[model samples]
Each structure stands twice: as structure tokens, then as C-alpha cells.
Target: MTQIVILAAGMGSRLGRSLPKPLTELADGRTIMQQQFDNIRFAFGSNAQVTIVVGYKLEHIIEAFPEASFVYNEQYDQTNTSKSLMRALQASAPGGVLWMNGDVVFDPMALERAAALVAREQSFVSVNTAKVSDEEVKYTTTAEGYIKELSKAVVGGHGEAVGINYVSRDDKATLLRQLKRVGDQDYFERGIELAIEEDGLRFEPVDISDLYAVEIDFAEDLERANLFV
Candidate 1:
């Protein structure tokens, strides 16, 4: 069974939404979170265990996805993805967790690629090599082509880490340790970078750029993503 987590605790003020960002309705008539759930069910089948970390307007998400397990992040307003992810991992069972930023809108094939990686028990950061936005989470690989630097501040980045990622069962403990070590305001990538630097965690950059994957942060991004939907 694949253990999946969605970080949906932020207010997503950038998107100007009164509701949770994951609940944003797309052109296809399904909300972003619903599409993510459907994509997971498609790739991982019925046994996939999904947990959502929620805070900002959590009630709407709970009402929409009542069957999903939830972990509340009371400090969501003060922290970032690192802390929200920490909460999920703390409550998780002994297994690798496949997780994504709640706002990503991607082709279903993306999760199929993710599912394949999970089956191999490979730790990875799903990447889109086609676009390397300076403002997005960028990554540079080691000589062995494993992820070396991963953050928005990366220099000469080869591509962007598209936010779909996994921690293998073996690396789970190490990642959790680093996540705890990260500051409250740091994104989860900081924890991964620390794990790689301090404990030598290997995270492969799985390229899924041929397939469409958009992280909805603004109205323009949502508009572009809707074209794929």
C-alpha cells in the first residue's frame, strides 16, 4: 500500500482564495484536491492510504474529503511546508510516504510515474526539466545525477522540483529527522537538502516534464493549468 500525504494547511494568500487552495475549482468542474485523490486512486489503486494536513479553512476540506485521514497543523499560519509535512510523517506508519503540494495540477501519468518509483522503494523528487523558474524550487544534481541542491535559491539549476516527491522506507527516518531540524518557515526542500548534506540521503530527480504539471500559485497559473484539464 502506498502512503500518500497532501500538504494543504496554508492560507494560500497568493491565490486570493477564501477557501483552502486545494479546494479551488478548476475548469473541469472538479476541485484540485479531488483531482489529486482521483489521480492517486488511479495510480496506486484502492489500498492507498491518504492523509491530508490541514489548517486554513480546514472544515471545507474535511467536509469534502471526509473519508481521508487528517492531521491538524495548528501552527500552519506561522510555519511552512516543512512543519506541516513533519506533522504528517510523525503520524505515519512505518513506510515511505508519497506526497505533493496541494496546488499541483498535473496529468494522471505523473502519478503513475510516482507510483512506479514508490514500488521500487526509490526516494525521489519529481522534476520538470523543461522549465526552470527562478521563483520555483530548483535543483542541481550530484555527479551521480542524484539531487544535490534543492531550493528556490539554487544557482544554475537544471530544472524545477515539481512538488511531487517520495521518501523511501529506508530514508523515512532520516528525512523526518531533518524535517524537525529545519526552521518553521523553511519549505520541505530545505529538510531534503539537509538530509543529503548531513546524512547522505539520495533523492533521484525523476523527470516528468513531457507530461504537464503546473503548481497553481496565481490566477495566470491556474488559467494555464486549466488548459490541460
Candidate 2:
């Protein structure tokens, strides 16, 4: 079974408000995290099990998703997603894990495809072959399709990370140890880069043409995510 881990710990200072990013209102009355969870559950089928890594107003998250198992990161404000992921891994049972940023909103098919891809390949990330946009966070890829470099700036690539990742059990241990070795990095992508360099844990690109997801960063993205609803 594929375990889904939703990372929702950030305080969303970029949103320019005191509100938690995940609880930001959408057009349909559901918060962004709730929308993400609903879509993931639908894609994973009724029997799907989920783990939510929460901080930055964890009480609200706990109250909102009473059924979800939670892993708290007290230093969420001081650390980055990579550290939150490492801590969450401690509580997680070993298996293939489909990890998504909680602030990302997408159609159910994207999550379904991610699960399918991980089950087939060792591990993969949902991405796109479209031309890079100014708003896109990009990565550099080798001819063999393994990620050679990653950057928030523009670069040559057939794909862009869509924030949905599938990690296999074998790669999980390797990646986690790499993250630990590179402790206290400001960004999770940094840990990913280290893992790729040190342990050869490359993220395969799974084209997300027929499916879509948007990572909510600013208020504009919060407005944009409502369109999918």
C-alpha cells in the first residue's frame, strides 16, 4: 500500500497575513489543506491511510482533521520542510510513500497517477513537460532523465516539479540519512539535492499533462487554487 504524507507545517509568511496557509479560505468553503486531503483520499480509494505532518497552528489542523494521525514539529518555525519530513518519517511505517505539500491543490487524477507511478517505478515525482513559467520553480535534468541540478531560477528542462512526490522504502532510508547528514538546511530541496549527489536517490519525472496541481504561495495562488474547485 502507498502511504500518503501531507506536509502542512509552514506559517505562510509569504501570504502576507497572520493566517495559516492551509486554512486560507477557498471558493467552496473548504480550506486549502482540507481540499488537498479530500482529493487525496478520493484518489487513494476508501481504504487509504493518511499521515499529516503539522505545525504552525497544529491545534487547528488537529481539530479540522480529527481522523488523521498527526506528527508535530515544534521547531517548524525555525526549520524547513526537509526537517519536518525527517521527523515525520520517524512516525511513519515503512512502505511506498506518496508525499505532497499540503498547500498544493490538484485534481484527484494527479494523486492517482503518482501512486501508480511509484508502484511501477522505484520512485517518481509528478511534473510537467511544458515550457518553464516565470512563477515556476525549476530543476536541471541529465540526458538520462535523472535530476542533475535543481534551481528556483529558470533552466533547461522537459519538466518541473509539481510538489507531488513518490518515494520507495529503499530510497526513503537513503534520502533520510542524507538529509540528516546535511542537517539544518534552509530548504527541503537542498536535502533532495544532497541525496541525489551522495546517495544517488534521483527523482524520476512523471508527466502531469492530463492532471494539474498548484502550490499555494501567495494570496494570488490562494485565489487561483479556488478555480479547480
Top model number, lDDT = 1
TM-score of each prediction = 0.99, 0.90
RMSD of each: 0.6, 2.0
Worst 10 residues of 2 by lDDT: 149-158
Off by over 4 Å in 1: none
Q: lDDT for every model?
A: 0.94, 0.75
Q: Kindly list the per-residue Cα lDDT of model 1 for residues 1-229, writing each as its tens digit.
A: 7899999999999999899999999999999999999999889889999999999989999999988999999998999999999999999999999999999999899999888788899999999999888799999999999999999999999999989999999999999999999999999999999999999999999999899999999999999999999
lDDT string for model 2 (82-200, tens) is 88888777778977677788888888788777766666756776777665675665677767887765546646655577887777877888777765665564456666777787778
Q: Model 1 RMSD to the real structure?
A: 0.6
- What's the count of clashing pairs in each model shown? 0, 0
